[model samples]
Target: MGSTSSGRSTGARDRDGEGRARNARPRDGLGRPLPYEAQGVARQPEGIVRTPEQSVAEAQGLLDAGRPFHAHEVFEDAWKSGPQEERELWRGLAQVAVGLTHAARGNVTGGARLLRRGAGGVEQWAAQSGRQRPYGMDLVGLVAWGRGLADDVEAGGGTVDAQARAPRLRGQVP
Candidate 1:
């Protein structure tokens, strides 16, 4: 009864009991919304608190699996729950994941811009905090990776293989 002429639901959007909008829509690997009836990759739950090590591990796995959007969500959780001093680190990592998602999804301009922005944010945070390898992350390597991927995406003007371009969260310093 809540369906529109197109046979899609037309009432209030899916929501939790608290009345907050919940997107029940399925999503592709890149996090693009799919039709309600279409199957989707499992979504990472929101707002869970995890230790820095756990966050890094989980996000790295997702990135390596070519699920950068999921990796972004994992980083988002850390950004929201981590200590104030580490918020920028997590936020920047999330942005880098999303940048990869954009590049994989064929948004070349947006992908390149976000990659650079995220790399710059990470670099700035490391300079300000002087914790280049917090929680075993190789900030310098990740920044260089993100920036280099951005350059490649821009030059190609096309989609990229997200897994192939995924950055190693832990890598040799320098």
Candidate 2:
């Protein structure tokens, strides 16, 4: 259910015709915003726009769908476009996806280290952004789960408890 059939259609229509109708913003086939339009951060001369929030949400959706490597790539692309303030935040998030990707592959030690670095960077970025930090399950929760996995690996733990964890945490494994 990560992908919706109407996403592209709605996004295109929203971009090409009705711009002021929706609050959720338009998205591309990949679920990322087209640029400048989604957030309505700035006015443009009539074209598609994608916002950081949309891009992050798309990446999060991919991560939730068991695609952290893809999520890492998406966030990396978003990060490369510099706004100075949000740039580092995207970078940290991209790293978080990478860390989660590693953890999913059972590389516990590497995942833990990357998670630590990402956590530090994202926490700083979140504070600076002054935006309520993204939902904890996305990044913070991943770091904790990665840590738990690392601890389990160190102590020779068993399979992670799917039922015991939240849905968002599921992204950490796959």
The candidate that achieves the highest TM-score relative to the unseen native structure? 1
The lDDT of each candidate is: 0.92, 0.55
Candidate 1 TM-score, C-alpha based:
0.94
Q: What tens-digit string does per-residue lDDT give for candidate 2 at 145-170?
A: 54554565446523222223212532
Residue lDDT tens for model 1, 81-102: 9899988888899999999999
Question: If scored against the real structure, what TM-score would every candidate get?
Answer: 0.94, 0.53
Can you list the residue pairs that collide in candidate 1? none
**Model 1: per-residue Cα lDDT at residue 35:** 83
Output the number of the lDDT-best candidate. 1
The backbone clash count of each candidate, in order, is 0, 5
